[model samples]
Structure formats: C-alpha cells, structure tokens
Target: MDKRNQSTVTEFLLLGFGDLHNFKILVFTLFMTVHIMALTSNVLVIVLVGVTQSLHSPMYFFLSQLSLCEIVFTSNIVPTMLWLILVGHGKVSVAQCLYQFYFLGAPVIAQCLLLAAMSFDRHVAICRPLHYVTIMTFTNQLQMVTSCWFVGFTLTFFIYIFLRKLRFCDLNTINHFFCDVAPLLRLSCSSTTSVELTTAMVSFLVILSPFIFIVATYISIIHTILKIPSTSGRHKAFSTCSSHLIIVCTYYGTLSSIYIVPPRDNSINMNKGLSVLYTLVTPLFNPLIYCLRNQDIRNAVYKYIQSFRRRKVVL
Candidate 1:
C-alpha cells in the first residue's frame, strides 16, 4: 500500500481482550451481568425520583440526572463490547469511533461537573441552610444541570479537533475494548504528544478544578457541622453529605489514578482495569449508595413499593 493509502484508515478493529479468547464466554457473561445490573439500578433510581413527589428536591433532581448520564454512558460502551465478545471481531468505522468517543467523553465530563454541583448543593444546604431554598430553587437546579450537559458536550470539540487530525497509517486496531482516548492515540502512526498533552491538560482542568471546588465546599460544610450544638444536627448534616462524599471519593480517586496522576504502566490491560472501575463499577454503585445509605431515598423507595403493592391489589 502507498504511504497515502496506509495513512487513511476507514475503519478500526476493536481488539477487545484478545488474550481472553479462551474465556470469552466467561468474560461476556460477566460483562452482561454487570451491564444489566448497572442499567437496572440506574433506571430504577430515575423512575423512583420521577414518580415519588417527595424526591422532587434539588438533591434528588441531580441524582436522577446522574442516573440518566450513567445510563447513557454505560450504554454507549458496554453493548458494543458485548457484541465484540460474542462475534469475535468488531470493526468500527472512523465516524462511528469518533461518535463513540464523543458520547463517552461528554457524559464523563458532565458527571464530574455534576458531582461538583452536587457538592455545592450540599454546601448550600449545610453551611447556608437559611438561604438553601432561595439558592437552589428548581430554576437554579435546572440551569445547573443544563450547564453541566452543555459544557461537557462543548468541551469535546477541543480534544476532538486534534483527534480528528491524526493519521492511522497501518495501525487501525484499537488496543482497548472501547474507543477511549488513550487507546485511540496509541493506534495513530503520527506523534500524539501534543494531543496527549492537550488531553491531559484538559482533563486536569475539567476534573481537578471541580474536584478542588468540591473539596473547598466540603471543608466549609465540615466547619459548619462542627459548629452545630446538637449531636443530632451534626449527624443530619453528615448524613446528607455522606453519599455524595463516597461517590466523589470513588469517582475522582479512580479517575485521578487513571488521568491526573502519573501512570505506573501505560499497558492496555492496566488501562482496561482502570476503565472498568470508572465506566462500569462506579455507575453500578451510585444508585446503590444513594438508595441504601440515604434514609430519605430509602423511605421514598419503601413508600413507592407500598403504593405499588396497594395499586396492584386494587387492580
């Protein structure tokens, strides 16, 4: 093939877990189980929030948005992976790969920012209780959710511009399961240093900035909690923030390890494991955390179940 022809790759082969060929069925089963579970849990949260009038608060509103994002995020990547595992080989067109990357990137960014917004919500509720209702009204919550989605979708253009310019040459096989930025960059024949640096910088700014803001907001929340004279008041304040804190810790901790911190090994397998943590595990856990830990959510869910039973009996 001529150099020009070699540089042009119309499609990409998703080389997903080629080493696991012997256990492909096992892998497929595991992934399918997790994917189904993640989807079911997140969707349940969304439905519960929608139907339960008591859950119409700003916090639950954000939780529902997060659940929706999780649904979209996992759907974009997991089904393709299942198909590839079942069929043995999967080819994705250049356009398809780019769209996959865009879809994945946008929600991940939006979720990060949403976590920050959730933290700010907690901050307002705890530290500035008197002004919480005024500050985090439905209109403000809607604007915040919209802003997170908008910024996440808009920011992809920066990385995608450079990503689109890269020539694949003869390398058209994506090492990882999905069309992740790191794996895609590895397949490019050209030097991706600038693109890599740009990506790293963008990720740091987008992720770390919100993370820092969340930390500061929590500090203020903590300070306020300590000042509360009654133990019950302090417990109430802590309970409100705990789920968000756990999520922040899990999401950002895995995220920073993958993107922000210096990588210990840039191996495909290593990245795959880290990717699973954030992409699959985190989404699965979010709804479980909220439903199990938060008394309000649990009560609402219980009430919903009772109502459902009562309606079924009547019918």
Candidate 2:
C-alpha cells in the first residue's frame, strides 16, 4: 500500500516442522539419513553410467542426467530442511530465498522435460526399433538434454524476476520448509495476480505439457507391445520401459496431489506431506527403482564391485 507504512523484509524465518517440539532431534536424524542416502544413490547412478561401457546408450545417458537433476533438486532443499528441523527455525535473506526457489524450480522443470525425453526414447526403441539407433544418436541426445536445462532455467529465471518485483512488508515468516512460490506469494504486499498468471503459464509449459507427452508416448508403446504375438516378446518390450513408467507415475502423482488437486481443510499439512514425496522420497527412490528393475544397471554395479574387489586383492 503506502510506501511510508511498508517495512522492508530483508530475510524470512522458515518455520519448518516447528510443531515437532518434542521430536526435533528425531526428525532431524531422519531427514539427515534420507538426504545422505538420496545423494549417494543418485551419485552412484551417475558414476556407473559414466564408467561402464555397456551403460553408454541413450537410455543410460538420460538416466545419468535424471540422477544429476535429483542430486541438485534434493540437495537444494534438504540441507536447509535439516537445519530448520535441528534449530526449530532458520533465517534466509531475501536474495538467498529467491536463489533457493530458482535452484529448486529449475532442476524439477528440467527433470520433467528429461522424463518426457526418456519416454520418447523408450517409444522409439520399442515402437520403432529399426530406427532407434539412428534417431537417438549422441548428438540428438545431447541436444535434448541441453534444451531441457536451457528452457527450465530460462522459464524459472523469469519467475524469479517477477518474484523480485513484489514487496514484502512486515511479514517475514514462511510456513513451509523452503521458499516455495505459494507461501512467498501469500506474504507479498504487492498484487500477485500477474505473477500467478505467469507461473500458471510456465507450469503448463514445463509440467503439464511434458506429462501429457509422456502419457501419449506410453499409449503408443503399449499398443506396440500388444501387437507382438509372442508372450515373451510382449514381456521383453514392456520391461524395457517399466522403470520409466513407474517413476513417471510416482513423480506426476505426487505433483498432481500437491498442485492440481483441490485443497481440503487440512491442505497446508497435506501439502507439506505431499511435498516430501516429490522433493525427498521421489529422488531417493528413483535410483533404487532403476537399479532394481533394470538388468543392465544391475550388471554394471556387479561388474564394478567385482573389479574393485579384484583390484583390492592385487594391492
């Protein structure tokens, strides 16, 4: 409103799980364990894909990129969350909060596009098997990954610009773990209608569009699998993309719950819980899912372990 009445808020107090008054230490321990596990698992995937010769296909290349995104996405929020859980609250300057938001959004948005690209890779491999090699060349794969990161960061940068324009007066407390767009918009004194509109457009572009593409891609894949007369043929075809399908379901399901579904009476708590699914649980489970389900990844891990053991014995 009036300039004289407004007090600039240089920082925000993140009230993360503050209600766990008697269980702060327990919660902190749990969060710390998950954070460490998630980082380790994702890093392992990246390393395996890079060093293993058999794992250098387009599929594994995309999986490595996905792991990289998970590493960035989880690391951006979980450390702050652990600190907040330990201390009951934490202060983040305005610039720092915006930076946090940017890092958070960029990886997620990039991952969304990457997932879609992965699905397309699967579709080509199964539905158009003859053309798979020529279509999914190293150059094409690099271009796809580059575009995902570029578009993801560029779109989020615009949202950050809009967020910076809003004035925060007096109110400096965030209910959620990190600086999410919803809580920040609520605390802004300036009109957020335009910002919300811009966010909506970007969400559609980055989230909804990619999800739809993945869905359509899977439909074709299923159709192709069904046309195969032999049962083993169908199974083989299905197995190729099943890991990606599971991840797509988990990722989009949690996202839809948090953002697309209508909020209920306990929406704030519900949102927080669902946020944990995508932000923490999904990343932690991703590499696990791929490792358990994909035979190549399993073999790679086994070979790497064997090699390490042999080297140790020699030394």
Candidate 3:
C-alpha cells in the first residue's frame, strides 16, 4: 500500500468475453439483436402508454416508467459489451468507467423502487377498488415516481463517491464486460472494505426491502382475490396484476442470484450469465410479457396498427 510502489491507472482494459474467441461473431450478433429488440420494445411501450387514452391508468404510468428505466439500464451497458465482444477487449478511462457504473446502477435501483411502487398501485386497485381513484391521484403518482428517481440517484452517488476514493495501481484489467462494482474492486490495489460494506448495506435497502414489500403486497392481493364470491370475479382480479407479478418474479429471481447469493470458486462466468438474464433478457421480455398478458396494452397496440394501416391505404 506504499505510495512509492503504486502506479496510477488512467484507463482500464475490459476483458469482455474474450475467451469466447470462437464465438465472437455469434456473441456480437446476439448482443446487438437483444439490445435493439429491448430498446424497441421499451420505446413501443412508452409510446403506447403515452398516446393511448385508455392506457393512462396508474398501472400503465408505472409501466412506462419501468420501460424508461429498462431503456437506460440496457443502453448503458450493452453497447460497451458489444464493442468489447467485437474487439476482444476495450480500453476505457477511469472517469468513463465510473460514469458507466453510476448510470447503470441508478436505473437498476430506480427500477427496484418503481416495481415496489407498481405493486402498491396494484394493491390499491385490487384491494380498495372504490378508493383506487382517490388514492392513486396524478399528484401521488408523480410523487412516487419522483421519489424513486431521487433515491436511486442519491444512493448510487454515494457508491460512486466511495469508488472514486479507491486508487487503482498498475493493474487496470477489468475481467467483466462492463464497469461493474465487483470487477473494478477486484482490480483496485487500495482497500475496498468500506466500498464493499456500503454497497452491501445499500443493496439490502434497495433490493431486498422492495422485494419484501412486493411479496407482502401480493399476499394481501391474493387474500382479497380469494374472498371474491364469484369465480369470474376472482379470475378477473388475478388477471389485473398478473403481468406485474410475472415481471417481478423474473427480475428478482435473476437479480438475487447474482447479488444476494454468495459467489463460489468458479462463479465469475456464472455471474456473467446471470447478469445477462437480468440486464438483457429481462428487459427484452418485460414489454413482451405485458403486451401479451394485458388486454389493454394489446388493444392499444391493435388500434394503433389499424390506424397506421388506414393511413397507409389513404396515402
């Protein structure tokens, strides 16, 4: 730890999937396709929610926010990943790496809070139908969304501050595709105990707390659904929040595997694989699941397509 022995690392070399040299082209094509599809789907969701009057409920509002997060989340990391795959390894300045971490981390934390807020929205709609309108006012929705973004960025800023304090020595190779905290910490010659501890505490608050809230909210939702006297009523109630539930499961399942679970001796590759699930696959599937399962989204999409077709015919 002596200053005399330390060499400043101005840039980092990301060793992104370089071992897969045989599948370089395949990996590049796959990542590019997923990135484009995730972006397109999230954008479509945002557009449909914005333009379609019938889709302007509190639920759809949160869905639009979630899509926006997905767009930011995937775009921040995937392009760099694609470049790394193509080049075998990519060089990035220390500042650029920290910026990447902030952008990527903020949206992830935002999405966690957003999902929790969405669960609360579903809870109000289902458990207190009569008060749903009064409870989920436009002002309230804005407050919830604002709080999510505010807390997300604020929490990540602290982590960024901690990261900036740690000095990297001569070793500047990041084993992962992106500037993830784990990889950067691995390369740092300075002590990372404080950074690791702060990250752990923040993860517990952002990830685990929201997940626990979502679970408790769903339990209440299910209890209310089961009490419905008519079978059709129960089915209808379940359908309303089912899409969000699916997304919650998929998002949290992959996320917990990577962050919550302890890493094993050969867990780097496994972590990368799990990272793909949450970062790439989850975003790609979110809008698809919602559109397929939610009647309102489908109707809005169908109506838009019909309108487009009619305009084409007129032209």
Candidate 4:
C-alpha cells in the first residue's frame, strides 16, 4: 500500500447504485418515499407512546428510544442521499464522509443493543411476571438505554478516527448510497490494518454479540410459549414475539451480510440490496410491527385520529 497516490486522493466518488438515466427519478422517488414513511411512522410511535400512558411501561419506553434512534439513523443517510441526487454532488468531503459514517454506523450498532434489551425486557415480562416490576425497574431500564448509546456511539466514533487517516487513491466513487465502512475502506490506498481491525471489533461487540443474545432469549421465549397448557395462552405469547422476531430477522440478517462477510466481487448487488433492507426498510417496519398486533396501540391510534377529527371540526 503506497501513500503517494492515496494521500493525494481527497474526496470519494460515490458511484451511487447504477449509471442509468432511465429510472433515476423513479428510484429517487421510491427512496424518498421510504425516508418519509420511516420518519412518519417512527414519529407516530413516539407520540402514541407519549400520549397513551398505558404504554409508558419499560417495553414501550425502550420502544420510544428505538424510534428516536431510528429518526437519527434515517436522517443521517436519506437527506444526504436526496440532496446528492437532487444537486449532483456525489463526492463528499473526507471529514463529512467520516462523520456521516459515524452517525450512520452508531445507530445501526445501537439498534442491536436496543433490540436485545427489548428481548430481555419481553423475556422478563413473560417468564417472570411476578418479579418483572422489581427487576426491570425504571433505573434498570434507564441503565440499559444508556449502555446502548454509550457502546454504540463510542465504538463507531473510535472507528471513525481510524477511517479518517486513510488516503483514498483509487476511484473516489463510494459504491452504494451512503458512505459505508466496507466500500470506503476498499478505496483506501494506505494500510487498512487498523481500520479493518477496529471495524471487526465493533461489528462483533455491537452487532454479532447482541444478535446471538436476542436469538437465545427468543429460544427461551419459544419454549415458554409452547409450554402453556391453554392454546390461547400459547398463541398470545407467540403473537407478542412475532413482531420482535421479524424485526430481528430483518435487521440482523441484512446487517450481518454486510459486516460479517468479506467484500466479494460477485456480492455487490447483494450488498446494495441488503443496505436498502436495514437502512430504508427496517425503520419503516418498526412502527408497523409495534402497533400491528397490539390492541392497545391500535386503540390509541384510533383515539388520536378521533381527537384530531374533533379538533378539526371545531376549528
């Protein structure tokens, strides 16, 4: 790895998805729609959780936090992507690129923590109904949320510093949409030893570790669900776990494909598709997953709508 050519390389060319003029507007519209839908749904979740006091329990408290993270996550990437597509500046400053990578990476890693904690919260609620209140106290819940942020942001920020030192000598085009760690690292002309190592460390700690925990916890949950003598009780337990399971599968599955595997020439399309899964699709699904089977959320949504209607009529 020679620093001569790399150090001279300043900005990155984000070769965005493809070089096709035909579907440009349609593709932009679709991505924008996802961004808007995600924001709208996540915002609705926040408001619903706030206004519906019954949802103020530890589970929904964590949910509210998840929604907040989602907002931060999508805003980091989608707006920039929209701007680039609209204004035609595909190359971003190195500093700006690193910063975007940090923010984007932080939320994704943080989501794993939040998701795992939520699973634990659910486990306690279902398995240990009697001691759930004492164990998952407000303080404990707060601690969990704090831990999620601390680990997420700290891991990504440190990694960002290593990534910033790399000199991009190759094609500056950042393949895919937002600045991802893999594609960015591939362009580095300098030794990527530290950058790659730090990335792997964060991936293991933030992504893989929590994914395993969530899976194990869900296994226990499934056993419990199966043990219920009454079919209705079993069904109810499965119902509660359904949304979380789907989200876990979607978020972790796509994310793991990107970070866990080495970059392959054949898998570029797969990476692009998976990036869309976690970035655009997951956020949109979280709100719906939360309220879909939840009677309380559904009721609150209706109540909120009805109140809005009454206010409009009065106005």
| lDDT tens per residue, model 1, 1-315 | 566666578899987766566788898899889889999999999898898888889999999999999998999998888887787778999888988999998898999999999999999988888999899989999999999999888887778888898888777887667887877787888779878887877797679999999999998999999999999999988988999999999988988877776655545578778887777788899999999998878898788789989999999
Question: Can you give the TM-score per candidate against the true fold?
Answer: 0.93, 0.97, 0.97, 0.93
Which residue pairs clash within candidate 2? none
> Candidate 2: where are CA atoms >4 Å away?
none
Tens-place lDDT digits, model 2, residues 132-230: 989999999999999999998999999999999999999999988999888899899989988899898998898899999998999999998999999
Measured by lDDT, the strongest candidate is 3
Report residue 141 deviation for candidate 3 (angstroms): 0.3
Give me candidate 4's TM-score against the actual structure: 0.93
1 or 3, which is superior by lDDT? 3
* lDDT by candidate, in order shown: 0.87, 0.91, 0.92, 0.83
- lDDT for position 82 in model 4: 70
lDDT of 3: 0.92
Candidate 1 segments whose C-alpha is farther than 4 A from its true place: 1-7, 19-22, 191-194, 264-266
Q: Which ten residues in a row have the lowest lDDT in candidate 2?
A: 257-266
Provide the lDDT at 216 for model 1: 97
> What are the runs in model 4 whose C-alpha is more than 4 Å off?
1-7, 87-89
